[model samples]
Target: MLMMPLEIFATVATGLGAGLALIIAIGAQNALVLRQGIRGEHVGLVVLVCMLSDIVLIAAGIFGIGAVITAAPAVVVVIRLAGAAFLIGYAVLAAKRAVHPGTLHASTQTGTMSRKAALITVLTLTWLNPHVYLDTVLLLGTLANQHGELRWWFGAGAALGSVVWFSALGFGAKLLRPVFAKPGAWRVLDGLIAAVMLFLGIKMALGV
Candidate 1:
């Protein structure tokens, strides 16, 4: 039989590959990241939360927490409800912004309150949603376990892939700052975000 070390490494690779594949798709998560990039506010903070959340969840999936979460069904329900509320509220805000996105402010200035708010929002949005656990813990976790000893390696690969994907997205958005500089960019972005949120919210509520 193969050693655990070799199996773990391979497992991590599998996890990374799976994560990167799922993450690259357009979804609420990606939309938020892009919107933040367009707004040019707390870019690093947002990106860090996004990446760290992935790492932690993927770890949970690969390691012991997957089993723990699986045993607790109500926990998932709570997350889904909370996430639904957030999404609904977010959708309203986006729609409102679509009508009136406010004045264009210089991206250079960072108010203290906005900074704190950005950090909190990103953390909550990343960690609080049931989908995060479902995707990372449930799906990825079960997938990792199937690899036997290689599961750890699959998770390691998945986490690293997350780092790579988020870095690319964060930097890529930065590169497009000029394109986002247009006056109506925020309104359009917010509108799109709202639509995405609503769609995601409905999906969650209906258990799709």
Candidate 2:
């Protein structure tokens, strides 16, 4: 009566697919990760935080936590709006740096945020945002709920999948830092980040 294996594989696929979809994007989280990676910051700590946050949410979902989250519609709306606003704000910051490339500095020298602070910032931005719950918790959890006996395995699979993707991204960015150091490379990257955030913010605002 319990289809655990199917659930696990399905969940794993969902996790991997979602991770791949968003990992390479120029969103705030990825930008922070890449910045740290290039500066040779506390990458291990960042990866751990990223993965743990995901696991917590996924675990919460399997335990019916999403039902509670979904029940609070007003809270969801507020969080979504706040997240979108933050993204837009970050986008502006990125665009400003892009046009004024001289303002950009070594991430290591930027005393604005230390490695621990940076990692926490990414974790909060990622986990506290409503979109994360909607994608990983509610959607993926609901999928797992369908399997009578396989739901547990599905949840495990999804969790493992998330771990794999984020770990890779966290470590993989270091390899790209050199290529990104070419003149105007950061400008292009910042511009792309700005564009993506603007697009996502507008889409969320429009209820799209």
Candidate 3:
């Protein structure tokens, strides 16, 4: 089936809006990206990984992989429990950082993460979170299929949304470097990250 230009535009716009609405939320992934961006630590690689992950997930969802995953309740449970544990552990680390805040320079010196470590961390953050599967694979997949034959276009739009958002977040975080230069600012940011992670961890654990 052929779609009119207007139909394509509308479908893309809908996908873009839905994608942004889901991804723009404050979560572990966003927090890590923001921190990496502000610290000037492999921002491009981080953003690229995030973008590619989302694109792949969104594609999977649109292509019916979501249905296959959904058929296995055990898989979801395992992912949820594992995700909860990781988030909680990360929360503890964030709390420690909050307690002993460091200036941007001090962080750069003592907290510098190797590229391989950063890559692994970002990938873990992206893949370990069950919310990614829920949002990208199930929800977005369902939404895309609603577009019928234009489903791929919807997925493309959602993928573009991910690219736009992660690019903005990872690159734009440096603009706040001035504010984050102080130890107090680091404390506040880490405190918030810890709180968010803990809340999410607890929520996931309780299956709430």
Candidate 4:
């Protein structure tokens, strides 16, 4: 069935709003992206990776991959466990950074991450996050399917939301460089990151 123009617009708007609601939340992925953005380390690549990942996941959900995933409980269990461990480990690192806060000019603290390391870290943060699957694949997919023939249009809006959000977060973080120039700010940011990671890690571990 061909959706009317107004119907298409409404579907797209709904998808965009839903996507932003889920993606805008504070999570490990956003924390890492914001940190990399502020440090000016692989910001473009990181943002691209995040946007692409979301697009792929959204597409998967729209195409019925979510059902396959749901049928395979083992896969989720594995991902959840792995994600929990990785999150906890990352939390420890963030806590250490918080304890030993470094100034923005400190190359060892802010600018020394190799491109390869940055890429790997961002990938792990994105893929290992089970919440990404739940939000993008299952939830958004379900929502899009409700649009019937306009589902792809909904998915496109969701993808655009991902692009807009990551672009804003990754690029906009640089504006805070002045505040981060002080070691105190770094300490606070890292402390918050640590807390978020730890909380998520524990929750995932318990399957909550």
Candidate 5:
């Protein structure tokens, strides 16, 4: 009995590590979450959306839905096109901000989006993107299925990773508010985000 628990724990740990490895990378979702965290605007709601979305996707992936989705090339193509457009548009905005970062303290107030708008933005960033589907659904699903009977536990562990990661990312960004209070810092951050988003957008557009 003790060995069973230990085995499950090990499986969970593996899932957690894999999940974090995929999620911790630079992406539009992470960038938006960090921005909300720094602004302290509806951070909870954003985190909730992100965490819940990952959980749902991971669950779907583990249940074999990912395989079905992967089999449908048209669906991926449609999502890829739509997501690429959105990413490029957002990249342009980020680039604008990078060029004119404005006062960091005032940046939050310059044109603070409504909670509803932010929610929509985050949802798009998370769901409309094909890369997210490929990562969480296809890759993670394949990995979980390798566990056989223990796949659900692995999915649960991945969900836990999402929870832990978003929590840390959303809340932890506040710790950097002091540093971001400087206009130069905001400029640098937004510039980096712009570059990352642009690269991702173009890559997705090219289907590379």
Candidate 6:
């Protein structure tokens, strides 16, 4: 009977490790989240959206929806186009900010974004990335199925990994606020963001 608990723990650990492995990478989503975190703008909302999106995708994968997604090539193409366009547009905005960076003091929050805009941006960064679906729904789903009857537990662990990572990422970024207190810091940060978005957008559009 004691072995049963050990088995469950092992399964959960496997899921947690796999999920973190896939997510803990540098990408457009992570960059956006880090920017928002540094600004202290809707950090909770951004983290919630990211975590919930992962849960839904992971659950879909475990429930056998991954196969459906893999079979639909056209759906991927459409999403790729849409995501690319959004990324390019966002890149332009970032570039503009870098060029004309007005008051961006971290203390007074001179450039606070509206909650609605923040939510929309977060959702786009989370859902519009085709990689999210592939990683969470297809890859993670296949991995969880290896756990047999404990697959749900595996999924739960994967979900928990997302929760832990994003919570830390979004909240932990506050430490950088002091560094971004200067307008030049904002300019440099936005410049980097623009470069990433532009590169990813072009890559996506070219189907690379």
How high is the CA lDDT of each candidate model? Answer: 0.75, 0.70, 0.89, 0.90, 0.89, 0.88
Q: Give the Cα error of residue 139 in candidate 4, in Å.
A: 0.9
Tens digits of lDDT, candidate 1, 1-208: 6576665666667777898887887777777777677666777888888988898888777777867877998888888878877777878877876776553332434222287877777776777678778788878888878877667777778778888887777667877778667647656777788998898887777667
User: Number of backbone collisions per candidate, in order?
Assistant: 12, 7, 0, 0, 0, 0
What's the alpha carbon RMSD for model 6? 1.8
lDDT of 2 by residue, 45-129 (tens): 7777777887788778878888988898788788778878877877798788788876765443543457667766787668646
Which residue pairs come into collision in candidate 4? none
lDDT of 2 at 116: 65
Worst 10 residues of 4 by lDDT: 102-111
Q: Model 3 TM-score?
A: 0.95
TM-score, candidate 4, is 0.95
Cα shift from native, residue 145, model 6 (Å): 0.9
Candidate 3: which pairs clash?
none
Candidate 5 lDDT, 1-208, residue by residue in tens: 2339888888899999999999999899999999889888899999999999999999989988888887898999999988889999999988888886662333457767689999998998898899888999999999999988888889989999999999999999999998877788878888888898899999998988
Each candidate structure's TM-score, on Cα atoms with residue i matched to residue i, is 0.86, 0.82, 0.95, 0.95, 0.94, 0.94
- Full-model lDDT, candidate 6: 0.88
Task: Provide the lDDT at 115 for model 6.
Answer: 93
Q: What is every candidate's alpha-carbon RMSD to the true fold?
A: 2.8, 3.1, 1.5, 1.7, 1.9, 1.8
Among all windows of 10 consecutive residues in model 2, the one with the lowest summed lDDT is 104-113
Q: Put down candidate 6 lDDT per residue, 1-208, tens digits, no spaces.
A: 1339888888899899999998899778888789889988899999999999999999999998889989998898888889999999999988988888874444565667879998998899778888888889999999999888999889989999999999999999999988888888888999999999999999989988
> Which parts of model 1 are misplaced by more than 4 Å?
1-12, 103-113
Superposed Cα deviation of residue 184, candidate 6 (Å): 1.5
